[model samples]
Target: MLATIERVLILDRAEEISKMVLQSEIAEEYFRCIYKVKNNLETQRKIREFIKVKEQYEEVQRFGKYHPDYRVVMIKVRELKREMDLDEHVAKFRIAENELQSLLDEISVIIGHSVSEQIKVPTGNPFFDSSSNCGGGCGSGGSCGCSA
Candidate 1:
């Protein structure tokens, strides 16, 4: 399985590669952490795929029993276990937790950085203004206030 390299800095054109690459450095540690995670997933997927590729690998030993990607991926896996003091296959779970938070943070930052007000008008009825509906769900046929 091919590893998906997430683009940290959104780019529009070819000229933006410099900016993307530059901003990528600001999140160097972030990207490094993400890469380790993505590579780990790829490694696990490859392990499953290896059952199919095993014959090809055997016939063509240019990459040997262990592909170069396997070593880097395995090293990251080992590093994660040692760093987190995790046992056996539990590191994958921990990495998912960390990566999920990192992903959420990155997305929040992106959204916060480029925020725009969305105008949601109630269809073509301009008279029925949402701003005027201040009674919460009461305006939508749901109870918001209690009977005294």
Candidate 2:
């Protein structure tokens, strides 16, 4: 019962901190960019067109060598993809989204590190370590089996 109450208090505090973070300048900018892109009719139309073309191309591919229009569909798909990538609004939105995602990823990593520390879990660059014998079975010439 006490543990449950403590957990609820911690969660409440965490939610409060999250609300504060969302009101910060960086979060505000992220939301602004996201809303701007979402509200753009032209951008939305282009995105829909691109998705339709991509789906058509995928369907053709799924038919394998049996589909006669596979080559033409692939060409159309590539063209549509290129045009979509060239769109200014779409490009800007992608950049903004990437930035926001990176920020979120960094925050998640920080929180993960904090939790790991409290739990006494080993945390650091999991990629390469000369001291630790827990060679991640990465099969890249190292004891870890992880492939390069």
lDDT of each: 0.44, 0.67
**Cα displacement (Å) at residue 41, model 1:** 23
Candidate 1 accuracy as lDDT: 0.44
- Compared with the true structure, what per-residue lDDT tens digits does model 2 show for residues 1-148? 4679879997998898788768876678777767866788877777788899888888988897689988888888888788877877778767766666555655555664577522211333343232234332335574453332
TM-score to native of every candidate shown: 0.22, 0.69
**Once superposed on the true structure, which residue ranges of model 1 sit more than 4 Å away at CA?**
1-84, 116-148
Local accuracy of candidate 1 as per-residue lDDT tens digits, 62-113: 6654675555545555554344444323355456545544544444444433
Lowest lDDT 10-residue stretch of candidate 1: 116-125
lDDT of 2 at 62: 85
Give per-residue lDDT, candidate 1, residue 29.
Answer: 48
Candidate 2 RMSD computed on C-alpha atoms after optimal superposition onto the true structure:
5.4
**What is the Cα-based TM-score of model 2?**
0.69
In terms of lDDT, the poorest run of 10 residues in model 2 is 119-128
